[model samples]
Target chain A: MHPPRDGRGPADPPAERRVGLILFWLYVLLYGGFMALVLVRPDLLSVRPFGGVNLAIAYGMGLIASAFLLAVVYMVLRSGR
Target chain B: MLHETSATAVAIFAAFVLGVLWLSFFLGRKGQSASGYYAAHGQIHWFVNGIAFAGDYLSAASFLGICGMIAFTGYDGFLYSIGFLAGWIVALFVIAEPIKALGKFTFADALDARFQSRGIKLAVAISTLVVSIFYLIPQMVGAGSLIKPLLGLPHEVGVILVGVTVTLIVVTAGMVSTTWVQFIKGSLLVFFCGVLTILILGRGLAENTGSLAPQTLTVRPDGTRLVDGKPQERGHDLRPVGTIRALPERYGSRRETGALGPLAYLATLEDSRIVTWAAKKRVDAEGTHTVFTPTERSGADLLKPGGSFKGLTTGNLADRLDFASLMLALFCGTASLPHILIRYYTVKDGEAARRSTVVGIAAIGMFYVLTLYLGLGAMTSGALDPTDTNMAAPLLAKTFSNTLFAIISAIAFTTVLGTVSGLIMAGSGAVAHDLVENVLGIPMTDHEKVRCGKIAAVALGIVAMALGILFRNFNVSFLVGWAFNIAASANLPALVMLLFWPRTTKQGIIAAVTVGMVASLAWILLSADTFEKVYGLSREASVVPFSQPGLVTIPLGFFVLMVVSLLTARPAEHRA
Candidate 1:
C-alpha cells in the first residue's frame, strides 16, 4: 500500500476521516469473518443457509457483491465531501 | 484431449488479433513524448482508465486460471478471486491518491519523490523489474495453453506468437495503446463471460450420456494409447469424460435438472451424485502411463474447499499455513504491483486515481461473481479434458458450440496480450526511467527516453517467452501466487514505512526492498513446490519448510526496515 507521506490532496474533516477508517475496518472484518470461517470451520461454510445455497457460497458471493457496494459507498462519501 | 481444429475458431482468432494490432498502430502516434509514452499524457478519463484497470488486473490467472481451478477443484479457486478483489480496499484507502499525487511516470518515481537518493532509485527499479517479470510468466503460460486447442500449435509457438505481437503493440504506442487494448479486451472479457454464464444457467445441469463406464487410458512403451486395455492407434485422442451419474430423481422421466437459477444450480449439484476423473501414473521399464480413472463423488463434497488446497481440510499444519500465506500475499500484493500502481499515474489527479480504483473494484468484483457460474458450469459440463485442468473453461465453451468456443478462446488470448503489455511497460520504465536516468545519472532527451523504453520492452518480452515455455505445466493462478508473494514482500513494507514512520531513512527503504526481494526469491527457489515441480527433484531435499514465504518474509521485511532505519536515522537536530 502506498502511504501518503504528506497531505497534498483534498483535505477532509477529522470526523469524515474517522468514519472512513471505521468503514474500511468494518469491511475488512466482513472479509475476515468469511476467511476465519474458512480457517476455523470451513465445514460450517458448507452448511446450507437457505434452500439450496450453502453458507460458504452465500457468504462468498456476499463478499464479492459487498466489495462493489463498499466501493460505491466510499466513492459517494468522498465525492459528497 | 480436444485435438479437433475448427476453421471458424481460427478465423475468429486471427481477426480479433489483427483488429487489436490495427488499433495499437492507430493510437501509437499520439504518445511520442516521454510523458505521453509512459503515462498516456495523463489524459485518460477515469472511466476508461478504470475499465482499463480491470483489463490490466484481470490477467489469464483471474480469467482462465481461476476458472480452471474452480472447474476442477471448486470453491478453493474463488478464494484467489476474493483475495485479489479485496486487495483493492488497501489500494483505494492507502495507495490510490498518493500514488497519483507523488509519481510522474513510473512506480519508482513515487517512491523516490520524497528521497533523492540514488540508492532508493536503484533498489526500487530492480524490485519493479522482478515483480513485473514474475507477473508476466503466468500470462504468457496462459497464452500458450489457449493456443494448443484453438490454433492446434505447440505451446512454445503460442508463447512466441504472443511475445512478438505484444512487443509490436508496445513499440507502436507505449501506454496509450496498452491502455486502449486493455480497455477493449477488458470490456469484451466481462461481457462474454456474462453471456456464457447466462447460457450455462439456461442449459442447466444434466446427466452424463448413457452408461457410467470408467474409461482407462494406457500408454504403451511406444507412446500409443490403450483405452480399456485395448491398444489404440496413434493420433486418435480419447473422448472427454466427467459426468453426473445419479440425479435427485424427482424429475418425471429424464434424469436431469432442466434449467437452474444461479443459486439452485449449486444446490442441485450438491444434492446429486457425480463422477469426476482421477489419474494415477504408473512406471514400468519401458515407460510411464497414466490411467484416467473415475471416482464417484457427491456434489456436496466437490463443492467444498479441500480439492485443490489440502490445507482447508486434512488438518495439516504446513498446508494450513501455506493456504493462509497465499491469501495474505494476494491481499497485500494488489496495491504493491508495479503495473497496477502505474495505472494511477495515467489519470489526471489523486481524486481521479481514487475514482478509477472504485470503478476497477466494481468491474473486477462483478466479473469474479460470474466466474463461479462459469467454473461450476464447466465442472459438470462433461466436456472436461481430464489431463489438463487449465483447458477446462475453453473446453466447456466447445461443449456448447464451436463458435462460442472460438470467441471465448480469442478473448482469453487478448486477456494475455493486455496483461503482458502492461507488465512489459512497467519493466521497461523501471529499466529506462529509473535505472538509467535516476540511478546511473544518465542524461537523455524525452524522445531518446522513449526509445530506450521500447528497447527494454523487447528484451523483457524475450525473457517472458522463455519463462513461459519453462513453466508450461503449472497453472496460471499458482504461478501468480509467486508473483504476489514477491511483490507484497518487497514493496509493501518499504512503501508503508516511508509514509507512516518518521524515522524511515533512505538506507532503510533500500535495505527493506533488497532483503525482502532476495529473501522471498530464495525461499521460492528452495521451496518444496519448486523442488518437486520446477526442478524435477525429490520434495524431501527441499530447503524451505513450507512452500509460501509471505508469512515469514512480509514481517521480516518490516523488522529489517525498522532496525536499519533506527541505526541509520540522522540526528534530530541535523534532520530537515
Candidate 2:
C-alpha cells in the first residue's frame, strides 16, 4: 500500500530500533532528573559539589558532556551490533 | 550606548557577505533537479553535513542572544545552551536514522510516506510553515540588530539586506548552496569563539574601581532625545557597564586575578562580587523615558540559576511550571524541527544520518561549552552595552581589539545568514513540495518543482523581513523559545507514534498535528507575556497560567493521537 520512494534507506533494523528507543528513554530520565532537581532543591545546586564550581555549573556542564558521550556510545553500539 | 561604526567592521562584514554570495552563485548550476534543490542530491559527506548541521542549528539566538543573556543575568542564559544541545540527543537516538529512511524532500514526505494522505500532507505542511516562520523571525531580528552596530545601518535596512541575500542563495542553488554556507559559517563561528574564549581566560577577571553611574534616556513629545538630562548628542551617550566589583579575600588587595584556569576562574568568580544592569521604563505626557540602572549582584548568585528566569528564586508554582515547560520544549523540539529533519535527507543513508548527528552534537556541544566562558567574561569585562543584551559578545570582543570585534561581528552576521537560509528552505519546501505537489495534487516536472520552490523562498523572505521589523524590540532567544514549543507540540507526537505504533492511522496524525499546532499557538497568544508585551495590556489580565505551553500541549498531542488512532483503528490492523 505504501508508495515507492527514492533516496530512502532501508527501515531501521528491529534490534537497532529497540536499542535506539532504550537509549532515548535513558536520556529522558537523565534530563528529567536535571529539571526536577532545579525545581525541588535549587539551593542544593548552589552548593559546590567538587569544591570547584557550584552544583549548578557542574551539573549543567555535565549534561552537555553526557549528551556528547552518550551519542558517541550510541554510534559505537550501533556499529558494533 | 552608542557605536562609532568602525570602518574595519564594515570592510570585514562586506567582504564576508560578498564571499557567501559568490559561493552561492558558484554552486548555482548544480541543483536544477528537485532532489538536488531540496536535498542536494543526497550526496553530501556526513562530516560536512554534520558541521553544516551545527551551522544551521546555532542561529543568532544561540550566539548573540545566549551570550547577551549570560553576560547580563548569568547562568540563566546558559540554561538555553544546555537545553538546546540536549535536544540533539533526541534527534540522534529517536528520529535520525528512521527519518532518513522515510522522508524524501521534506518533513511532510516522511509523515505522509505510509498513508499517502493529502490531509496529512496539508496539515504537516502548515505546521512546517508555522514553525519555520516562528524560527525565522528571531534570526531576522538578530540580523537587524547586528547590522546596526556593525554597518551603522538602520534596523529595517539590515533585515531587508539579510532577506534579499538569503532569498538569492536559496533561489540560486537551494540545498547545495545552503549546506556549504552553513558549513563555512559553522566552522568560522566555533573557531573564532574558541579563540575569544582563550583570550578571555588569558585576560582573566579584573575589578573595576571606576564610577558605576546610571544612564537615563528620556524621549520628548517632539521626538527629541536626552541622555543623562542633556540633549542626545553623538559624543555624549550612555556609558558601558558590567564589571567585577571585588575579588575574594584570598587575592588580598589585588584588583585583577592575573590569569586563571577554567575551574579556577569559575571558583574565583563564585567568591567575587559583580555589577550588572537593570532597566526601568515609564511613559509620561512628555514621552517615554528609560533608565539603565547598575545593580550589584554576588558572583555566586549570578553563576547559579534564577537571575533572569526569576522562577527558581520566586518558588511560585506557575513560574516553576513555565521553566519546566520551556526545558521540555527545548528537549523535544530539535527532532521536530522541519529544517533539521530535512538535513537528514542531505546525507545518503540512515547510518550517515546517525553519524552526522553525532558529529553535529560534538561541534555544537563544544561551542556551547565555550559560550559559558564567553558570557562570564563579558559580564566582568566592563564593556557591556546595557541598552542591548544582543551586543554583549561583539562588545566583549571590542574590549580586546577593533579587528577582533570586526571578525566576531562578521561571523555573527553569517550566523544569521546561515540560519535564515535553512529556515527559508524549510518553508519553501513546505509550500512547494508538501502543499502544492502533494496536497493540492499539482503535477509538475522536476524543473517546474524547482521553479516553484524558488518563488516560495522569495515570498517567505519578504514575510520574514516584515516580521523581523515588526518585532524588532523583542529578544531573539525569547522568540526562538516559542518556535521550539510550537515544533515540539505539533510535530513530535505524530512522528514518534507513526514510526513506533502500528495502529496510528492517518486520521490520528492529521488530528494530532492540527490540534497541537492550534493549542500551542492559542496558548502563546493568550499567555501573560504576550498579553503584556504584544498587546500592551496588564499581564494579570491574561488567561493562561504560564507563558510556555509545551508541558501541557505536547502531552495533549500524544493523547489526542492515541484516542483518535484507537477510534479509527481497523479491526485487522488493531489485531496486528
Candidate 3:
C-alpha cells in the first residue's frame, strides 16, 4: 500500500500541538466574551416583544468570530506545514 | 391534514431521494472493495467531501429540533445552534489532521494507534457504540415523527420504512452512498430553508384578524368548558391563546402595537398574552389522574425566561456554574460525536476532512440563522402546536399554504433519512471494525470484514426501529441532548489528550473512556429530567443535583485521565 500523503506518521510527534493550544485558548476567550455580552446586555439575548428576535444579531457576531478564528488557524497550520 | 398530497411535492422528495441513491450507487462502484465500503478508500475529493459533511452533520435535531425550540422558547433554542457550530472549530483545528493521519476505519482505530493495547480498543469501541446508539435513537424518533404528519401514516410504519431504506443504502453502498445521500439532503435542506425564510420575509407579518381565533377550553363541573364555539381544549393546556401582539419599527427600540401585517408579524410579540396550562383532574372508576389544559399568559410574568433553569438563577454558585457547564458540553459535544467523527473517514485525506468540516459548518451555521426567522414566524403565525414542538416549522408552512406544508414535511423526512443513515453507518462500523475485528480478535480478511459490517448494519437498523417506536412520545431534540452529553463526556477527553499530550498512556485513555461513559450514563439515569421525562416519576426522587450531566461528567473525565496517567507513568517510560 502507498504510504500516507501527509508526512507525519502514526509514531511522529504531533505537529499541530501548539496550534491546538492556541485555538483552545481562543475558544475560551470568545466564549467568555459572548457570555459577558449576554450578562452586560441582556437585551441582546432577549426577544423583542414586537419585532423579530434580536438575538440573531448576537448569533451573527458569534458566526463572524468563529470565522475569524478559523481563518487564523488555517493560516498558522498551512504556514507551519 | 386538510390538503391533499401535491404531486409536485411528492415528486420533488422522491426525485431527491432516488437521485441521491443513484449517485451513491454509481460512485459506490469504487467502494466495492472492503476499505472503500468502510471508508471510501480514503480518496474522496475535498469539495464533494465538504458538501457531504453538511449532509452528515445537519441531522433531524438541527433542522426540526432547533427550529421547533426557537419557535417555542425564544433565544434559548438558538443556543443549540451556537454550540453545534462552535464544535467545528475543535474539529478543524484540533482533530482533523491528527484523526486523518492516525486511524483507518473507526475512532477506536485512532485512539489505539500508538498503543495497540486491547484494553484501549475495547474501551473506545464500547464508547463509540454507546454514543452512536444514543445518537441513533433521536434520528429514528425523528423519522417516525415526520412520517406521521407528512404521509398521514402510523409512527411505527415510518420508523420501519426508514430503517429498511437506510439499511439497504448502507449495506449496499456503505459510506460512499451514505456520503452522497447526506450531500444531497444537506444541499436541499439549506436551499429550501433559505427559500422559506425569504418567503417569510416577503410576506412579512400580518394580522390574522380574518382568521378565527384559536378555540380555548376549560375543565368544569360539567364536561369540558368551552369559552367560545370551537373545540378549545388542546391536550393538557387551557386558557386563551397568546401570540405576537406587536412589532418593532425602524430601530430595535420603537415598538409598533396593532395587528401586524403578514410580514410585520415576524417582529411582534404579545406583551399582554402568555401561554400556560392548568392541571386537570381525571376521574375514572379506578382512580383520578391529573390532566392539564394549555393556557395563555397575560401580564409582566410572561416576559421573563422561565422553565427548567429558573432554579439556577436563584441557587448557589454551583447552580450558576452548572448552566455554563451545560453550554460547554453542547459546544464541545459536536466534535466528539462518534457519528460525526466517522464522517472524517469517508473522505480521502486530512485536507478533505478539513474542507468537509468547513463546508458543514457553513451550511449548519446558515440554517441556524434562518431558524430564528422560522421560529419567530411559527410563534406569530398561531401555528404553535402546544402538544408537539417538533411540528412547529412544518405547521408554520401549513398556515401559509398547503403546498408549502407538503414540501416542508417531505424535506423534514429527508432530514431524518440523512441523519439516520450516518448514525447507522457509525454504529455498524463500530460493531464490525472495533468490536468484531479488534476486540474479539477475529481473524478475518478485509473483504470478510466488509461483509460482516453489512450484516451488523442490518442488525443495528432493527434495533433503531424498535427504540424509535418505544420512545415515540419524547421530543426528538430533547432526546438528542442526552446523546450529546454522553458523547462529549466519553470521547472528547481521550481523543484530545491522545492527540496533544505526549504523556497520555494507553491505560489512561482506556480508563478515561470507561469512566467518562459510565459516569455520564449513570448521572443521566439518576438526573431529575430523566426521572420526570423518561421514568414518569417525580423529579424530587432523582438523586442527581442537576439535570444536565455535562457539568459533572466532563470534568470528571479529564480528572480521571490525568490521575490515571500519573499513576501509570511507568508504562510509557518502560516502553521507551
Candidate 4:
C-alpha cells in the first residue's frame, strides 16, 4: 500500500502541491488575458494561410497560451513551496 | 546574404570544440568507477542538473530543425514546442519522484526494481538502445548540416567530428562532463536565442523583403536542370549562381506604407496573401522527382490544411483522429524518452529532478517562444535559402550582422555537441550498465565497466556518424517525429505500467517492451510516409494503414502487459 499523507510515498501533500495548483490558475488567467487580446484584436492571430492552415498563427497563439498556463502552474507550485 | 565563411565563426567553432575536450579530460579523473561515470554518483547540483536537462533534452531538432521549420512553414513548426513542453508535465507530475525513488544508472533499473528478471533487463536494454539510436540520428544529421555552413566542411566531416568529440566526452567523464557540457550549451542556447528574439522583435518586419541569393544547384545524373531548361553540369563540375525568384507578396496598404511591426507582420499576412510551395518536378537519374513548390494561395485555399492533416479541411473524423494521434505521440514521448528519463538519475534527489525540470521548461519554453518570431522574421527576411531550410535562422542573423551570424552558428554547433553527448551517454549506459552488467551477468569491476562503456560509446558514435551521413537530405525535425513516435509507443507503456500497475510482472514488462518496440519499428518502416520518403517506393504499396503507430502500438503494449501478467501470475507464484 501507499504511505500516509505526511509527505511520504505518493499520497502526501507535496510541499509544492499548492504551488502547482496556483500555477495552473495563473496560467489560465494569463491565457485568458491573451485570449482577450486576441478577441479585442483578432488581427494578432491572423496570418494568410499559404494554401492551407496558417500554422504560424495557430502555433504562435498556442505557444503564448501554453507558456502562460505553464507559468501559472510553476508559480502555484513555487508559492506552495 | 553572404555565403562567405567568417574568421570569427571558425575561431568560435574551434574554441567551443576545444573547450569541450578540455573539460572532458579534466573531469576524466573522477569517472573511473562505473557509477561515477554513468550517473555522476547521483550527486550533481540541482541547478546544474536542471540546465543539463536542457542540454540533454534540446537536440539539433529543437535548435536547427524547429527554427528552420518555423521559418519555412510558420506555426506548424511551433507545434513541436507544445508537444515537447506538454510531455514534461508527465515527467514532473508522474515520472520524476517515483523514478528517482526506484532505480539508478539506467532506465532499466527503475522498471526492474520490483522484480529481478533477466528478460526484463534485456527487453528494457533493447528498448533503450532503439530509442537512443532513433534520437541520435537527428543530432548527427543536424551536426552534418551545421558543419556545411559554419566551417564550410562537408556533411560527413561534421558527422565524424561530432562522433569523435562526443565519444571523447563520454569515454572521458561520462555523465559528469556530459552534464556540464549540456548545462553550458543549454544556458548559452537560451540566452543567445533570447537575445536573437529581442533583436528580431526590435527590428520588426520590413517591406521589399531582401531576396535570398539562389543556392548552387546540382546537375542531375540524367543531364537535367532542376530549374527551367538549363544545361546540366558534367561530372562534379558546378558554378555558383543566383537563379530562383523570390515569390512576390501582394502588399496590402499597411505593408506598402512602411515596415511592419511584430503584430503588423502577423496581421498583414492574415489580411493579405502569400505564396507558398504547392508541387513541382525535377528530373534525376532514378526518374522524375516531384516536390512541393509553394505558390501564391489566397482566401479559402490558404485556410485549408495540408501535409499531415490534408483531410482536416473537409472535417473528416479520420483525418482529425490522425492529427490528434500525432500530437499525442509528441506530447507523451518527451517524458518517456530514455535519454530524458536517465537524466533524473544525474541529480541528488527527487526535489532536484523536479527543480531541474522547472528550469528546463522555463529555458526551453522561452527559446520556443523566440522561435515563432525568428521564424516569422526569416519567412519575410527574403534571406531564406530555398535548398537549405536548415540555415534559416543563422542566415536570418547574417542579414542583420555577420558577427551575430558567427555567434549563432557557433552556438548551433554547440547545440549539436550538447545533445549528441547526451545520446551517446544514454547509448553507452545501455551497453555497459544495462546489457553487459545487468542482463548478461558479466562480472566485472566498476572501473572495467566504465572502460567497457567508453568502448561502447565510441562504437555508437561511429554508428550515429554513419547514419547522419546517410540521412543528410531528410528534414531533421521530421526524423525527430519518428523518434518520438517510437519512444512513446515502446517506452511509455512499459514505464507507466511498471510504475502504476501492481500486477505488472517482470515477464509482462519484457513482453510489452519487446512487442511495443518491434510493432512500432515495423509500422514506421512499412508506413506510407516511409515508403515514399526513404525507400522511394509507391505509397500505395505500403501495408501499414496509418503513418503513425502510437495510437495502435501504445494500447497494444498495455494489453500485452495485462494479459501476460494474468497468465503468468499463478505460474510464477507456484515456481517461487
Candidate 5:
C-alpha cells in the first residue's frame, strides 16, 4: 500500500518521528524476539548468558531497559534537532 | 490470611480520601465550562500531565496485578509489563502528535474529526464505553481486595466505596481533579515501590521455611468466611504465605545472603528453592472451600516462561496460540485505551503530547523494572496470601513495616481512585459529548453538557460497583487482559486504517468497530477461560479454540475495515 498524505506514514518523516519508529521496532524486536523464543522454544531461555543471569531474565530485563533507553533517546534526538 | 487492620492504616486511608475530596472540591470551581470540565481547559503543564499520564496509565492492574502475577508465577508476569509499555511506542510514533492535533474531549472526537459522521461517533462512542467498563472492572476489583485487609471491610463494600468516591470526584471536578489525583498517586506509588525494593535488597534473601502451613478457607454464599473450619474472629485472619521452603544445592546451607546488587539479587533468586502455593477451590454441600497447598519450585524453573501462560510449556497448539494472542493484544491495546487516549487532549499541542508520552514511558518503565524486584521480593518475603494474588504487593509492604503497609495500601487505593475516575470521565464524555449530543442532536448548553456528564458518571459508577462485586474472585491482571483484547480489536483497526488508508469511509469505520467489538466480546465469552471460570462449565466443552481473541479478532477487524472501506470507497471526501 502507498503512504497516505496524513502524517502517520512516511519513510522519513522528521528526525524525531523517524527515531521514534526506529526505536519502536528495535524495542519490539527485543520484546517480540524474547516472546517468540518462549513460544517456539522454551528451553532456549534457560541458557545462562553468564553466571546467575539466564537468557530469560536477561531478555525480560532487556525489554524493560530498552523501553526506557529508547524513550530517553527519542527525547535527546528531538531536543538536538 | 491477609487481614490485620491497624488503626494507623485506617487513619491514613481516611486522610487520603479527605485530601482527594478536598482537591476535587477546590478544582470544581474552575470546571464549570465544558472545556475546563472535560479537557482541563487544555492548560495542564507538560511535566504534570506527563506524570498524570503515568499515574493514569499505571492502574491497579499495573501496580497490583502485574506485581502479584510475577510474585506468584515468576518471570512470565513481567511480560505483561513489557507488552503494556511497548504499546506506548505506537502512541509515540504515530498516535501521539496526531491525536493531540485532532480530538477535543474524547477519543471519538479524534476519529470523527475528519469524517463528521454520526455513524463514526456512535460506533466509537459505544466502543469507548465497552472498553472503559471492561477496564473499570479490574480497578474496582482491586479496590475491593485492598480494603478487605486494610479496613477490614467486605469486598463489595470496598467496591461501592471506591465507586461512590470516584463518581464524586468526576462529577465535581472532572479532569482537573482526576489529573491531580493520578499525578499524586502515580508519584507515591513509584516512590514507595522503590523504597520497598530497597528494603528487600537490604534485608537480603533467607530460607524461611519453618512457617509453611497448608490452610483451607471456606466462604459461604452469605459472605461468612471460615478458616480451617473455624470462623475468623475480628482482627485475626488467614496466614499470608509464600516462603522459601527449601534451598537449591548451589546455595547449600547458606541460610541468608548479604545485600546484593540488582543483577545479583535476580541471580540469587534463580538458584534458590522457593515454595509457591497451589490452590484448589471446591463448591460443595456446605460452602465453597479453597484448599491452599504448598508446592516447592526451583528458582530456575520459576525464572522461566510458561508459569502463567500455559501455552508456553506443556499446552497443545491452541494453548500456545492463546498465549501469543494475549501478548499481541497487550502490545496493541496500550495505544487504543480510551482513558489513555483522552489524556492527549489534556495537553496543549503535539509537541507537549510527544514529550508527555516520553516522560510517561520513562516513569512507567522504571516502575515496571521495580515490579520485577517487588514481585520477586513478595515471592520470597513470606507475605503472600495464597487465596488472593492481588494482595501480594501490599502485603509485601506489610512485611517491612506497618507504616509502609499503611502508606502503600492507601496509595494503592488512590491508584484505584485515579484510574476509576479516568475511566468514568472517558465514559461520561462518550455519553454526553458523543452519544447524547452528536448522535441524538440534543443541542444543549455547555452547563447542560456538564450536568449530563455528571449523571452519566453516577450511572456508570453504579455499573462498575456491581461488576466489581461480581468479579471479585478474578485476578485483576487477567481481567485486564480481556479489556486490552477488546480495545485492540475494536479501536486499533479503525484507528490505524483511518490514519494510513486514503480510501477509508465513515461507514467502514462504523462497521469495523461494531464488528470488532462484538466479535471479540463473543469470542471471549465462548472461550475456554470463560467457560470454566465464568459459566462454571468444562473447558473442554467450550466452543472457541483459543482462550484469547486478539489473534483472530484483531486481524479480522482490520480486514473488515479494509473490505468495507474498499467497497464503499468514495473519492475526494477524506483525502488524507
Candidate 6:
C-alpha cells in the first residue's frame, strides 16, 4: 500500500529518475534540431529526400513517429516488476 | 455562407446531447465526498483516463481548426500537428510521475505541497483561473460558430447552450462524468476520422479541366449579398472550387489514380499541379467587395512550409522568429496547462499516471497522422466554402453523404463539450480548493467543499458564455495561441525549479509566476498582430519586435526564479 498523503512531495526512485532525465533531454535535442533546421535552412526543406516526398513532409512525420516510439521505450524501461 | 439546416442533422445532434446529459445524472450519486468530486476518488481505470486525456487535449481547435488550416494553407497546418504531439514527450518523461505524486485536486495543490505558504497558493491559483478562462474562450467561441451551420441557430444561443450543459455536467458528477464524456468523445473522433481517411484513399485525386473563372461576393451596407454580378439566392449559387489541374506522366493520360496507399498518395500529389485560391477585399460607395482569385501552382511548392507562413523561404528574419517562438511555446505548453496537470490526480499512483500518458500519446498521435490525409483530401475535393475555413472537414464529409456529415458534426460538438467541462472543472477547483480553503484559511467539511465547488462551476459557466458572445468575431485559433503561451510562461518555470532545485525559496516561486504571467500578457497586447487586429491601428506602431513571446518570456521566467532564490536563500545549514 502507498504511504499516507502529506505536504512534502514524494520522490521517485533514483534509477527511474536518472532514466527519465536522459530520455527527456534526448527528445529536447531531436525537437530542437527540427526547429533549427526550419530557421536556418528553410530552403533545403523543399528538396525531395525520399519516395518523391519533400524533406518537409518526411521530417515532420519523422518527428511525430519519434515521439511515440520514445514514449513506448520509456514505459518499457520504467514498468514495475 | 448559407447552410440549409437538415432535419437529420438536428435529430442526431439532439440524441448526442441528450445521451451525454443522461450519463451525468446517472453518475451523480457517486461524487458526494471531496475526493470523489475533485478526482473521482482516484479510482478511474488507466485506459479510460488515457483516452480522457485525448478528449481533454484535442479541443475544437485541434479538429476543426487544424484541419481547416491545412486544407487552406498546406504544410503550415501540419507544422502545428508536429509541434503539438512533441510536447507529450515532456509530459511522459518528466511531468507525469512527479505531478501524480504531488497534487490532490488543483494544479495549485501540487505547487503548494512543499511550501505550505499562503502566497504560493494565492499566486498559483490565480494563474490557474486566468489560464483556464483564456482557454475556455476559444472552445466556447468554436461551439458558437459550429452551431450556426449545424442547428441553424444564432451564435449566442449556441454559446449559452454549451455553457449551461457543461456546467450541469460538472455540477452533478464532477470529474467522474467529465472523464467518461471525454472517453466517449475521443473514441468516436478517432474511429470516424479513420473511416474518413480510408474513404479518401479509395477515391484518390482527379483533374478538372473546366473553366477556372473566380467568383466575387459583395456585402452591401444593409446586409444584402451579391455574387458574380447577381443577387445571391443560395450558397450553391457560388460554385465549389479547388481541384487538381494536371497529373504526372507516370499515369500515362489517366486523369484519376484510384485507390492509393498513404505514401503513394503524398508522392503523387507532389508531382501534380493543384489549384489554390487567394482572397482580396475592397471597400467603396457600395460596401465591402471580396474576391476569391484562383491560381495554379506545382504541387511541390504547395506541399512545403510557405503557403500560409509567408517569409519562411524568403529568409525574412521577423517572420522566422515568430514561427520559432510559437513552436517553442507549443513544445513546453502541454505539461504546464492546468487542466492537463489536474488529470494526474484522477489515477491511483505515479505508475498509473505514466502509463495513461503513453496511451494518450498513442491515440492523439494517430489522430494527427490521419489529419494530413483528411486535410489534403479536402483540398482537392472541389467543395470548399472559401468564406469560412472552419467548415472544411464537415463539408468534405458532405461530399460523401449527408448521414456521414451529420455524424461528424455531432462528434465535433461533443469535442467542444468534453474540453469545456475539463476547463471548468479546473477553474472551480482552483476557486473552492485553492483560494477559499487554502489561501483564505477557511475551514470546511467534505460536504461543504463539494457544494462550494458546484457553485463556483455555475459562476464560471456564465462568465464563459458572456466572453464567448463578445469575442465571436475573433479568430478561434489565434486566441488558443495566447492560452498556451501564458500557461507555459507562468506555470512551467515554477514547477520545474521546485522539483529539481532544493534551494528554491518560496519567494522565488511567487516572483516567477507573477513575472511570467504579467510579461507574456503585456507582450501580447503590445504585439503587431494586436496592433492591427485589436487596436485597429497600423502594425508599424507596435512596440514588440515579434508576436509570440515564448522564446523571450519563457527563459525570463527561469531567470527570475533563479535570481530570486539566490537573493532570498538561507545558509546551507539552515536549509530544510
Better of 1 and 6 by TM-score: 6
What digit string (tens of lDDT, one per residue) describes model 3 on residues B1-576? 122346665676566567656776677676677788888877777677777777777777887787777666654566666777777777876777678778888888887877778898888878888887888888888877776666667789888988887888888888888877877778888898887887776655543322223433333445444333333434423222225443333324343243344324333443334343333344454333444354444322332332323433354554555556667777778878877887777776666676666666667777777876787667556665554567778878877787788778777877777788888888888888888888899988878988998999899999999999988867676778888888889999988887656677788988899999999999989988789878978889999887778878888888899889978988656464
lDDT of 1 by residue, B1-576 (tens): 647788999999999999999999999999899999999999999999999999999999999999889887777888888899988887887677766777888887877777778898898899999999999999999999999999999899999999999999999999999999999999999999999998998988887754455566676777666766666544545667667777776754677677788878888888888877777777777456677777788888887778888878987888888888888888889999999999998989877887898889988998999888888888888888877777888888888899999999999999999999999999999999999998889999999999999999999999999999999989899999999999999999988777557678788899999999999999999999999889978888998888989999999999999999989877881374
Model 5, runs deviating above 4 Å: A1-19, B211-213, B220-224, B234-237, B248-252, B571-576
In Å, residue B259's CA in model 6 sits off its true spot by: 1.1
List interface RMSDs for the candidates, in order: 3.3, 3.3, 6.8, 7.2, 4.0, 4.0
* Number of backbone collisions per candidate: 0, 0, 35, 19, 3, 0
Best by lDDT: 2
TM-score per model (chain B): 0.96, 0.99, 0.87, 0.90, 0.97, 0.96
Judged by whole-model lDDT over C-alpha atoms, candidate 1 comes out at 0.86
Ranking by lDDT: 2, 5, 6, 1, 4, 3
Kindly provide the TM-score obtained by chain B of candidate 6 when compared with the true chain B.
0.96
Error of 1 at B401 (Å): 1.5
Error of 2 at B357 (Å): 0.3
Fnat of candidates, each listed = 0.43, 0.68, 0.13, 0.04, 0.49, 0.66
Between prediction 4 and prediction 5, the one with superior lDDT is: 5
lDDT of 3: 0.70
Superposed model 4: Cα runs more than 4 Å off: A1-81, B209-218, B222-265, B277-281, B284-294, B298-308, B314-319, B571-576
Worst 10 residues of 3 chain B by lDDT: B299-308
Model 1 / residue B377 / CA error / Å: 0.5
- The candidate that wins on DockQ is 2
DockQ each: 0.46, 0.54, 0.23, 0.13, 0.44, 0.51
CAPRI level of candidate 1: acceptable
- Model 6 clashing residue pairs (backbone): none
